[model samples]
Target: MGANFNLKTLTVALAALSAASIASAAGLDRSGQDITAFLQDGVYAEAVYTYLDADVSGYDNAYVGADKNAYQQGNKIDDIAESYDFFRYGVKADINDTFSVGVLYDEPFGAAADYSGDNNFVAQGDRDATINAISGGEVKDFASAANIVGKIQDKVENGGTLTAIEQAQLKKLGPAVAVAQADYNMEGEGTNVEVRTENITAILGAKFGENKEFQVYGGPVAQRVQADVKLRGTAYQAANGYTMNINAGQDYGWLAGIAYSKPEIALKAALTYRSEIDHNLNVSEIFPALAGAIPAAATGMNGEIDITTPKSVNFDFQTGINPTMLATAKVRWVPWSDFEIVPPLYNTGSKADPTNGPDGLSLVSYDKDQWLVELGLAKRLTPALAVTGNIGWDSGAGNPVTSLGPIEGYYSAGLGAKYNLTENWAISAGGKYLWFGDAKGQIPNKFAVSNFEDNDGFALGVKLSYQAKQNFN
Candidate 1:
């Protein structure tokens, strides 16, 4: 029993490590464009390198306490605490002094979680029960354990026959089995819950007046999104279980934004707005060996998943209090309500019948509209060097419910420095820390359960640039 416990602990740790590695491998968006006014000029070209690291810890009770064989061990999972790093490079240039264009290449979104493996710490009976539920009896000879347990419970409630030994076993195994099954189904048959998105955007800005005090900028933006979705564990049969590998596809989308800034009166303010984009993704499924039971309708499953990324508006203001001192403030409004994931052409009839069809139809939804505020101060230490520090707060989305999303609100603080290597060249480096708030969600099953947790992380960034002397009148 002691050896068993040790092995179980090790298994859980491995599982958690695998999950964290998966989550961090995608290397999505780590930092936004620098808010410094000096980099906004049309005649300069800049390149930036950013590193983002995060430690995510949370429980997903989406199916908690639902299965007869499910168990809960403090809602702790193996791969909850993980870290990720991202690297990005971008370039901006001025064309003919009136038009400015820039391009950015980076990973914008990614997710990773793993629960299917032989080393899983869950007990054999509990794992088997959850697998049966998710496989939908696709496996032969499994006896549909969940169904059997449900029937047994119903019989007991109605005063059915049960020997003393049977009664004792049921009482001893019920809760643990149920919780373990819930965890298994969640790790195996639950939603793929992971995503990886890579995006590239091109921007253009223009100045109207010769003095260049006033300007208007807008441009077309395009992105290519790739999604790798996994099938739930319950969808697989043990003897001849169905195996669905990662589903990957690319979609094209576009956006546009406009901004204006003025810098003469020791005061500057700019407003920018961006639009949303949509993706129609195509998905395919692969079957496992020995399951020759492919129905005629299963020949070539083709479908689309619609995704609308969010849009946002940004406001930035700055003032010079002294020759070498400056203060700045920024605010952003993001339309989270518009965020949604809708699968195309769901078979409602098939979903209604668990015995003869696929998993039920469901869509990904979130109430995520939010606001971000930031304040910073900068000081020029010498003719060739300057440093700045800032703090920021992000309000939680009105509705903070998600199966795999870890936290809702965040607090961040950062420091940055710039050094002029030459009259026309400069370099900058910075780092930031983020604190995330806890979040909770429920899993739909016979037993409605809840899961909650929190997360946090840090980010580092560097920039290199070359600038031309200002052609001021």
Candidate 2:
């Protein structure tokens, strides 16, 4: 029975691995080639974990906020999103004196959790009232202008109305109402998504003439992916007028690259480019008991949503400054502008057939393009020990962003060390600190509310490796 249980666990693990590969291929970005190469150098197996925190505050009414609210509040919401963690394991094998292969399992790209509460209400008061009136009322004449007036009248009677004595008072009241409506919309509340990928890469490398100062390698790569997405909170529930279930999918993709290294000058550089993958996801639009409250036309399927992962480029270089010190630098570019996930028929430019989803709403394009830069230095403490530190910066994507994900840029610092345990064994450890910058978006005439705050976090990693007894011939 114990053996059977072990086998069952192994089977489940394999299935999960397969699903992760597919999901990675469909929507993930694999651009940390240098880091992967460092892990593939053989002589050891390593594990690394990373955590990042972002505080996105400020309201400009030019973009979407956590609550899907269109108004802005003077005091931004202090949103604490779900934390991020990743694990990686790798091994290297020599096919001959000049050829070798490496395999790795890790999460290259993933995102989960968004803002919560009625944060958006500070920005989208009018829109929220409009929607509630259309959906909550017995006479659902959404297209009739008279219905809007009736809703306002209802609000006035219910003491939800705004009263002003002069232009200044009216101005203040208008923004206040807008903010309330925005909160009522609450589109991004309790939204969470997770994606993981497992990769297998093969490489053939060769050393050049005399001193073995130069070496080059190239390989073909494949990956699988798995993903899960969930929507919660009052905003989503209120907007749907029904309870909703989590949505999920699985997919796959491939990668390839070549690298060169020189030991004489203590310099190494490599370039890697990953291709994009697409997923034909099977998504479900779950409905809760409140679903019965909305009209049947607004309660069902929004059709198929297409999620296309983005592609990226990575470049890394490192060199020794002297016998006791070394420096390393890296850069990454991602074309987020092309990133889009549109539910079919919803935003197809036709308003007559409202069959796609509520009010023909869609995810549309993200229109983001960004870059990151990193620099590090290492010092040799002894023949068997070394220590290193690094700092990095990420540029912000363009304004008028459309994706639900918040935040602009990040600043990070980290430390790492290596120690020789014995003649054939060694150990490595690393830690990082990340600081997130503020981000702002617009919600029209409503109040502007920041979704998060300026925040920071740390990461820890360790690796163990053993030198082979003899080189394979």
Query: RMSD per prediction, one decimal?
Result: 13.9, 12.0
How much is the lDDT of residue 253 in candidate 2? 54
TM-scores of all candidate predictions against the true structure: 0.67, 0.66
Q: Write the per-residue lDDT of candidate 1 for residues 1-473, one digit (tens) a residue.
A: 11112211111111111111111111121233222222255445555555556665444232322253343433443343234455444566667556667666555455544433321222233465554344333322233444555666788899999877656435433432343344443443433445555666666667666665455655555555555443333312221122222255454544344344444324556676656667666654332221123332123345556666666566766665555666777777766666755443222322433743366533344566667777777667776777777777776554244434434657877777777778667777777777766555322212212244556777676667666644533
Show the lowest summed lDDT stretch of 10 residues, model 1: 13-22
Off by over 4 Å in 2: 1-35, 38-44, 53-71, 74-76, 121-189, 195-221, 226-251, 286-304, 345-364, 400-403, 441-453, 467-473
| Model 2 lDDT tens row, 312-427 | 77776666566566677777877777775544432332232244345554433444676778787777766677777777776646443332345555677777777767755666
List, in order, the clash count of every candidate structure: 20, 56
Give candidate 1's error at residue 15 in angstroms: 41
